[model samples]
Target: MPDQAPVRSSALPVSDWQQALDTVLQTPVKARPYSAQIMRQSPTAFLFLIDQSGSMDERTTYRGRVLSKAAAVAQIVNQTLLELALRCQKGDEVRHYYDIALIGYGGLNDEQAVSLWSGAAVGKFFLTPAELAGATLRVDEVTVERNIRGRAVTVTEKRPVWLNAVHNYRTPMKSAICLAESLVGQWLATQQGNDVYPPTVINITDGVATDATADELLACCDRLKALRSMDGNVLLMNIHVSDERGNSILFPARADDLGTDQYARLLYDMSSEMPTPYHADIASLFGLDQRTSYVGMCSNADMDALVKFMNIGTPTQHNHSFTANLSSEP
Candidate 1:
């Protein structure tokens, strides 16, 4: 480490979910349009790092039947990414301002870990989130079963469904991050020579670092913050999942606002700005004139508690004041 000190970002502290949403909503277009393109020299990119270690195989009751935490997360992220990837002029499943890369980590039967490949890696039928969302899952519904004190009840409920997002994974999240670095490096090289900068990277995880790869993950993300082009810079956002509960398990349970939880506030603090197009639009969707929101999932109280303690996204105290600190350092 240099005598200079670590880079501190300029994000704001959140008070609740609504506050986070408000910030998210306002992030893209305060001054004008083309927020996405304005932010990224070329099309923006969003990478989803989903944790699929074997630990995720642990089954728990939702409605009535048992389901794994990995399954639930895969569904949510898949749906979100598929939706995020919009139609470009090509008429194919191309994104106008958003491009997605679904990286799976910790799912393996071998000795080495950190399998950070796209969604199609589990199979070859389809390759992207758009394709995965269109695929069918073995189970269409999750049975909602909850134990109040000790009693167990079963109920079957259908969600959008997911396929191949997870399978035979282990907990080498950090190792997966190393792979992420390599892929990202390749991507950056291609972009740098062309003078294009992407938007952000989104990471979704379910457990702690057994591989002790936080530094690697942070390093990869840090590189993201450094990427600059005619637009602005790339950002890396982290989404931590407990993959246990339904509505109540997540902070600021109400989607309408984000002003209630300390954890929610921290999440926003670490959140990257929305892609340019979404900047003004997301706020419009939330009916917040100018604000951002914090969005994430947790499996249960234990998971929620853990996320609260573990910081995500960009921390507060970010200042682009010092030129040296503001510039990319690798």
Candidate 2:
């Protein structure tokens, strides 16, 4: 037989070795994708999937006081929305930098997973920053400490309450993840050609899925990450609110960091990898070194870590000027 030309790995016909080399070199390298910034002109969405199962009713100590997981989640969601709204605030109006969703799983009256907002907001999946500000059911005051002149000082601030604490019978986590996927898909469709940031889905649960098996939950997570826009795919974050007391795990690079807990490892696998720019913020805010691989997940998170996780997930580069309202010791 006569000598034949070289063939590429794909078995494509090539005249010579150079042509095969060219074909190999022509293979495109995919860029490492990252999360997009939420802006006014091109806004992003935030879908909060909360587990309101009966297990959430189990009380746990947070900040010297005991509160149920349901209570913690409600406070965290409301506070996070408030912070996002503040970030979008310019002059007197709230910029539409984000569209927010609050989906609660395992409710008695509601189905498996449904929008927990009341009145006209029940059927709505996404709410603008302004709409979120107005959707609050009530406002209550809470006291927090701030470091002033190297001393902790108490301060009182008005806190808005949106979703109330609810402890239901079963945890329909599969339904919650499915709802999140649907909402994320719809949001991505709206930003088809735009350079808008991809939506972020954060699921705060007790690490127990009563409605579906482990495989089904993982499938739902895969579906969520598959939804994308021009900027990037949806970022899925999970917070396992364990009632067990001890050191809480934040942003673990390996499954070993999560100990031998299978559920925690599962959540770690199902989470989005932390983006580059977010590393600094995570390290600075939560003191977690993200130079290494760490997915957006926290297992058995305490109240402080839970709040920090929320702040880390929704970030703004804008710096605001503030005037002192209190008298200084100096």
Candidate 3:
């Protein structure tokens, strides 16, 4: 038989295309978001919206060592990217199971939100695991104490540095979120009918957005969360880091729990509701009551809490299954 040409949307009649779209729009979404398994063919995404405002220059402590908030955040973000890249490694090959983007706001005097990837990945909005690993600017040896056989000892480990400490100008958070929404919408357009897990946007900041009011920022967040894939709507997780030494709110179920702190409550309202799948992990990690609902926002988090919060926001529980599948593949 002669080869038949594939049908293109532009070639279809208006009514036909509209009917097809309506069918897809009416189709029921399967399960909740974040439940889909991340595979090479059906991958997921993570967009880190970092605040590079002048307040980030304040000092903070991590692992008993004092550093600027921007420095600490860069460490946490670099470590997370390293872990993610490692998870996709199968012997000599790295699988492209996830697309990652990093946006740093207020890093320049112009108050623009821009991609933070340096070296070979500069100006790129999204990068696969292999591309990210190859785009390292340089490697640094970090000293840390570890407990081995019940004895604590100092050790040095080599860490890749993808992002540098950037602190300048005021926080243009609204612009950052808007940029993320645009990038995520473009990404989902490529995914189309694929049953991929929804993207997660983790916004880390030390202060309020200077470009927009609280209500305005929340409206931008709502638009970002509205972008979705076949799996579910996108997740917007916010983390407010502070240098103050005191009790921090990790995740609150209700606005009442946030008390009179308008900034904290604003972040809480801007955050997405924690999905049920993550409730168990949050409960086990933070000892929260599993029954209570939680928002994906953290207020006044120190360096330690920031690390843990980032882990929960990034989805990597499927690494074991992904590895198994890789082994079975010839």
Candidate 4:
């Protein structure tokens, strides 16, 4: 039998340790804008962190269909994944244009955020378009009545469900941010000089964190968004699902619009400011006036607005025409 060679360990020489430390500490971080073109040359990451606490059981209306917050969020995530997969498909092949992750927090007793994908998708950090298309366990059919123009129409849709609707204990938002931070750091390390689009994180939650303070949660989110690639710093978006029947607020320029709600203000402060492209897109879609600066935070968003928010975050930069052709697809 051949004997294996012994492993050797090496450390920086005492003579050069000080110089090495000085060089490392003196390095500066450069900030960039989120205007990179997302293409094969610059793949991107889209991460979703969902809160599945007891509050998710609150009922809300989405596009005239009434469902729980958990179910609505699950449906939105699945639909976005399907759209992304379809966007990257050409003649039965899926391009590696983006890496995606969906995480859920607040359901398990451990209070840790975990991958929401089930069956063959467990423990997977990143999935390509093809993998995401094949990652779902089952499909559900849903019917809804919608007013199209001046007439009422019945719409039937096929939806995938990788993660089930779960409503358990309190929310652990900090843990979810920690999980995302690790993933973003790993992703950024892989794209040191590739000019890759920075990772985008979309978090859906209903209430405040139970295990961590608001400041702690914000710090974690700040750390996550601080991760960057050559293109830009990471973008963190927040969607606050509310059971209140009051008017829903979309992207706002200031926390003053959120009133005295501390939770909403915290989320507003934690969110990334939406780039100018988003304002243009939003204006085109809804004919709303453009704001000078919009933060990626929404308070009491309903189903229609939620879907629009997802579309904005999961943009297909080069394939913008794909959805226009499949607008009537079930």
Candidate 5:
């Protein structure tokens, strides 16, 4: 036989995900892709899917100090949440304006992510406030240690803060995406019940697909679109981080900045634009401008990525969509 192009793996375990897509497409599933309830009324939900793969521990030294990748990420995440909280529009608290969830992927499997606010071991849906401030969460730290007392403790001090967030679990990046899709789908359905925009999901990854998944990503996103057609607010952004430099690589756009990687940029874009001076430094440290609103994306991450995702709904004015990648080059 003549040589042929190699087949691209069907990002999912074949028909299992496809079956879900078929069912979703056929049945007018409610726009609650985030919560599993009905939200035909809210404006949107904000979600973060991060890559905690071993590679996240990228090493760098400053002032005779060694920083692991995960630790760097923790700082960014801390800031992200604080900005998110501080910048939320007037009268908007954590309960409304957003139902944020964080999912981390890299080290464990099935034991994926848990909500920092509610501390819920998640398979479906996001975490609650009580769950977000678990034993593992702290808004700020003063020291940096990967092996704290020989234990894996990264965030020694926090420049940013922690919101009820999620962490990466296992080593699969694509599985996290699957979860993101399901969550976003559920949130959108519910938001519609409350007359909302459905949520925006952002994902970040350093490695390629560990499990088969992605076909469902597009299909799932398409399903999210089905909820509102043109006026809908649901958006999904993915960022692929390379073992590149420290700065963010830009995904330039004419009216907006859009990138290709999908994971890292999502974080940069989703942050709140209007923050109190308390969060303004952190927000400004990231690419966020006081003029723009953002949807989310994946990121190569820094102190900036986390700030953006947590504050997705902070500003009263809604944000549009944004980039996905690592480093500041975008």
Candidate 6:
């Protein structure tokens, strides 16, 4: 047979990769609310604004041990990070279901805020579960009490440490929030679609912002909360830790519930309203009746209340089915 010219394939030229990429990117993503199930494809983000102000040096009781407020906050935050890593663990693999940032303010004499990631993840603003798992600064043995078969027993376990307690200078809360706003804005810009659950910002502070007035701080928070995804607005939760033994006000439903305390009311105003999907979890976690939505701010929180408040702010608790599915996978 006579040689014939080769026919061109129907596929587009390899040089047209950008057009193919644009086509894939332009596909419509179904929009969902805050109830969207978090998975590897649409992972969530957590930004922790930790207060390392001079007031954090005050003594407080945490997990039955007396320590500085900074120490207690570090412990709780470390535990929370560990729990998040564990949740993302399926078999031997640590899935990337979250991007976490830990920013500590007022920890230096210069009143600067900076990333708190230690070890391999030092100087990074955001981290994946696998990165966090490998970035431990140290490991310490921790003792805890547990009930088994109607008997209470104490046990010791090794806990990895990433953040350390640092108490110095004054609270630069406004600066920290502004930095968070910048970081979150950049993060949301990179998200593939609007259906990803909005980032959650948990501000753990012991005192008022030294750089900004109450109104200014609230304005900063307003700007942060206004940055939203299809799942919902960015959830800004404030936790005011105190050494005083006063009763803590948590998840209050009204400004009236905050009484005449001007700072508490300001925090209430700064907080994002608790999303409807979280109402059931809040009720179950705090033993409250789910009649109305609550504010995301907690005032005068001691170490114990601080832990409970942190639990409610974190998005991991809402992904029970995700964890179950991961467990069942081979």
Best by lDDT: 3
* TM-scores for all predictions: 0.50, 0.80, 0.86, 0.81, 0.52, 0.84
Q: Estimate candidate 4's alpha-carbon lDDT, on a 0 to 1 scale.
A: 0.72
Superposition error at 103 for model 5 (Å)? 1.0
Rank all candidate structures by their lDDT, best first, as comma-separated numbers.
Answer: 3, 6, 4, 2, 5, 1
Model 1 CA lDDT for position 89: 19
Residues forming the 10-long window of minimal summed lDDT in candidate 2: 320-329
lDDT, each prediction: 0.42, 0.71, 0.79, 0.72, 0.44, 0.77
Candidate 5 Cα errors over 4 Å, as ranges: 1-43, 60-66, 87-95, 110-124, 128-171, 213-230, 242-249, 253-330
Model 5 worst lDDT window (10 residues):
321-330
Higher-lDDT candidate of 4 and 5 = 4
lDDT of 4 by residue, 1-330 (tens): 111111111133533443443332243444545555666656788898889998899888776678988888877777788878878877777777788988778776437777766656555767777787566878889887899999999999787776677788888888888888876666655554565667889998888888788888888988777666655568899988876788666777888888887777888888998766567776655456777878888887776777877877776534343223222221
* Candidate 6 lDDT over residue span 124-218, tens digit each: 77889889866777899988889999999999999999888989889999988988886776666667454567789999999989988888888
Candidate 1: tens digits of C-alpha lDDT, residues 20-76: 333333333223322322122344445556667777776644334457767556655
lDDT of 3 at 330: 27
- What's the lDDT for candidate 3? 0.79
lDDT of 3 by residue, 1-330 (tens): 111111121344555544554443454677654567678888888899999988899999987889999999999999999988987888999888889988888877435688777677665778899998677879999887899999999999999988889888999999889888777766665665787778889999999899998889889999888777667778899999998877689788899998898989999988898877677777766777876688999998888888878778774445322222222332
User: For residues 1-330, could you state the per-residue lDDT of candidate 5 as single tens digits?
Assistant: 111111212244544544544543454434432232212123345677677766666663323456755665555555555544443324433333346676666544433433322223323245433234342333445676687577888665454344222234445654565566565555433333243434556655555555544454344444443433122335555554444565554322221354354533333433222212213333444554443333333334433444443443223213311211001211
Q: How big is the positional error of residue 144 in model 4, measured in Å on the Cα after superposition?
A: 8.0
Write candidate 2's Cα lDDT for 199-239 as tens digits.
78999988588878888889999988866665556789999
- After superposition, the stretches of candidate 1 with alpha carbons farther than 4 Å from their true spots are 1-41, 59-66, 84-86, 89-99, 109-169, 193-199, 213-217, 243-330
